[model samples]
Target: MQQVFVFLILACVSSPGTPKSVDVDTDDDVLTGLEKKTLELETQIAGLKTEICALEMKMKEERDSNQNQLKGVSANVSDTMKVVGDHTAALATLRLDIDSLIQSVNSPPPTPAPTDVSVCPGDDWVEHNGHCILFSSESVTWNTAKVRCMYYGAHLMVVDTEELNTFLKIRLRAPDGNSHYVGGIDFGQANWIWDSTNTEIGYTDWRISQPSNGRTEHCLVVCSGSTCQWNDVDCYGNKKYICQKAAVHG
Candidate 1:
């Protein structure tokens, strides 16, 4: 509008007598050029606004995608922690169970109360050390004595302790001396093993210089001497035997 006013003033000054129609025509041409430039600038501004809006929308979408991925990662982390916690609890419980099992294994078994000798199964049987023992008066070979004891649902006596050995020595004492077969036998290994359980004998009452025969003397016998010590002997020798069985509860 200013340029239009300026051109009008110039035309009036430079040509006072010029035709008013020509001046008005020149003013119209200038107004048309300014309008075209204004339109072009407005169009460029509109295109720039559209581009800014597109860029903002794209940035917003990217931000939302990143947020969603973060949420998924957080959820996976929570789930992994939960699983780890569960395993930790299970491991703690298993450790407790193992400790309990170890304690049970290490604890000793309860000892039963002592029983009276009168409660033995028969008149010929004697109660000693939680067992009922029968001392056979008849003599037999070691193998035959073992079979005879089995016939009575018993095994040859196994004296595993010093007290039991002393008790048997007193019980087997008689005016006429006689040897008795016990449970021990060497099964070609040179180590004396109890026939009752096939376990190596851990206790013995061997007399001085006895068991000197090595493999030749494969059987055990309780001698009738005053000391009533043990001696390795020939398995085929005839001897009285002792049989033993667990005592009846009732």
Candidate 2:
């Protein structure tokens, strides 16, 4: 197209007989066509540039979206891992508890053996001649005193031998001249008997001219006088009593 335009320009310049006005009109028309073509080319270039910019924008947007999706997937994976780790820890703890429970169920409890008794009596009791004796501080009737002794799982002092009688004679002496009842009582029998054992009295330490055999003098006592001899007294006599029990083994 440029060559054709150049040839036309050359023919007009070389033809001496061509009208000047006609040649000027042809040059104007050719210049106008070239300008129109240039305008069209500029319009196409601008449209291409617009399309390329729009495509670039779309690509950029797609890239951003893909990056966001990748990030979301990573976060989800991280959360899933955390949950799995927590579950694993909980399972481990439960397993440990179950194992401990099994071990406890399989094991038997231990049994305690019996312990020996102590040789010495507890407080408020005295050990003498293989016996534990407690002297009552309060005086009461013979029956009441016997009941008191029974409350302690004991019996009133029983003089079964000469040695025990002598011991009682020496120990029964009170500073206030107070007498203590013994386990001896006649009840309705001719012979004195032990109230606790219901057996005949084996020994006696009666004072001089004592045991008048009075019907009312059924109960006996270790008289508080300096003599400390066994004396018959009324059954209802209020006198302190002695309590005796077997000594425990240590």
Candidate 3:
């Protein structure tokens, strides 16, 4: 409208009946000024768009960088968790080993008793020195008597000396007057041996010609006396056997 008004004014001024002067020059200058202003506004808007693009790109870069860092951190945490799990397992194994070692180091050691204990709950088996002795008066086969003694967790008696003989004299069966079977006779090797054990023969009270290695004598028997000794006899001959076990036969 202003340009139109200027044109009308110029038209009027330049009319054949009218006169022209500096008005035209001033209007042209105003038009030039408006055009310059428009150009400047456009330049400023373009600069703003460029700056916005740069900022958006920078923001995107930062976001991507942060996400990458987060990923790294997450990976590190996963690795750390795995390491912790491994360490926990190792600690558990170490604890188990430590417990085993503690048990091995702190547990009680076995005593040097000849026999650890007797199965007879009532203390029926006599405990003398370190040996647990059980005397049987009922006449039985050598094997049967031995089995009975073992049922009580013992074996046939082992008479080593006159002292042991005297100790067993009180336990002997006098009513039957039957010589009991005692652990002796190495007839397996044609010599005297404690059939109850593979013990090194320490003490022996061999009656004269007692172990004659006779065919009828496959076993040995004992009686109480300073001259108490092993007598060879048939293994099948039933008698009251003296069954004994060591108190601490270590």
Candidate 4:
């Protein structure tokens, strides 16, 4: 409207001497140029708006992709942590089982029933629970004591019954109580058996925590005193021992 009004004022101000028809044509040409410039500007503005929309869409897609990747990474980390937790729990349970096994191995059952017999063979040997037994007066290493008992046609004492175990405990008390070597041995196999019989024990009387798994303690002993019980000791150490033999008249 402003351009049209300006074109009308230019027509009115033209000198009477100029031709009206020529001025009208010049005004029309000026109006056409202005309209063309306006149209071109509107086209450029539309193009810029399209480019902005495209850029916004591309940015949103990238943002969505980044968010998905973050979620995947978080899930992977959670799975890894769960696996580590499970392994830790399993290791704890396994450790407990190993400890229980070790305790069971350290404590074993007793020996079998003794052979039937009526009378002991010698004056030095005494009859006890159907077996001939002799408690030595001299102290010696476990190996030496074993050899000495073998020389006497006997083996180290095998307390197969509670009665024998009690009797020996009392007998040792009578004269200067001390430890005595027995027939039990481990042999580093984690199994305690009678060295004399080469058999697994079926009857036993162990101390409060007897038969410990010491590396060098392969020999067994009857500990001294009223509260005496079986114990493991080093084979090379000196200690008194008991000898045993099956009696006659079975």
Overall lDDT per candidate, in order of appearance: 0.86, 0.84, 0.74, 0.84
Task: Quote model 2's TM-score.
Answer: 0.50
As for candidate 4, its clashing pairs are 110-202, 110-203, 110-204, 111-202, 111-203
What are the per-residue Cα lDDT tens digits for candidate 1 across 22-87?
889999999999999899999999999999999999999999999999999999999999999999
- Cα lDDT tens digits for candidate 3, 148-168: 988877888777766787676
lDDT for 42 in candidate 3 is 97
Off by over 4 Å in 3: 1-120, 170-178, 224-228, 247-250
Worst 10 residues of 2 by lDDT: 112-121
Q: Kindly give the stretch of ten consecutive residues in candidate 3 with the minimal lDDT sum.
A: 115-124
TM-score, candidate number 1:
0.50
Regarding TM-score, does 1 or 3 come out ahead?
Answer: 1
Tell me model 1's lDDT, rounded to 2 decimals: 0.86
Instruction: Give the residue spans of candidate 2 off by over 4 A.
Output: 1-120, 174-176
Per-prediction TM-score to the true structure, in the order listed:
0.50, 0.50, 0.44, 0.49
Two-way TM-score contest, 1 vs 4, winner: 1
lDDT of 4 at 187: 91
Clashes of each: 0, 3, 12, 5
lDDT computed for candidate 4: 0.84
What does the lDDT read for residue 196 in candidate 3?
A: 78
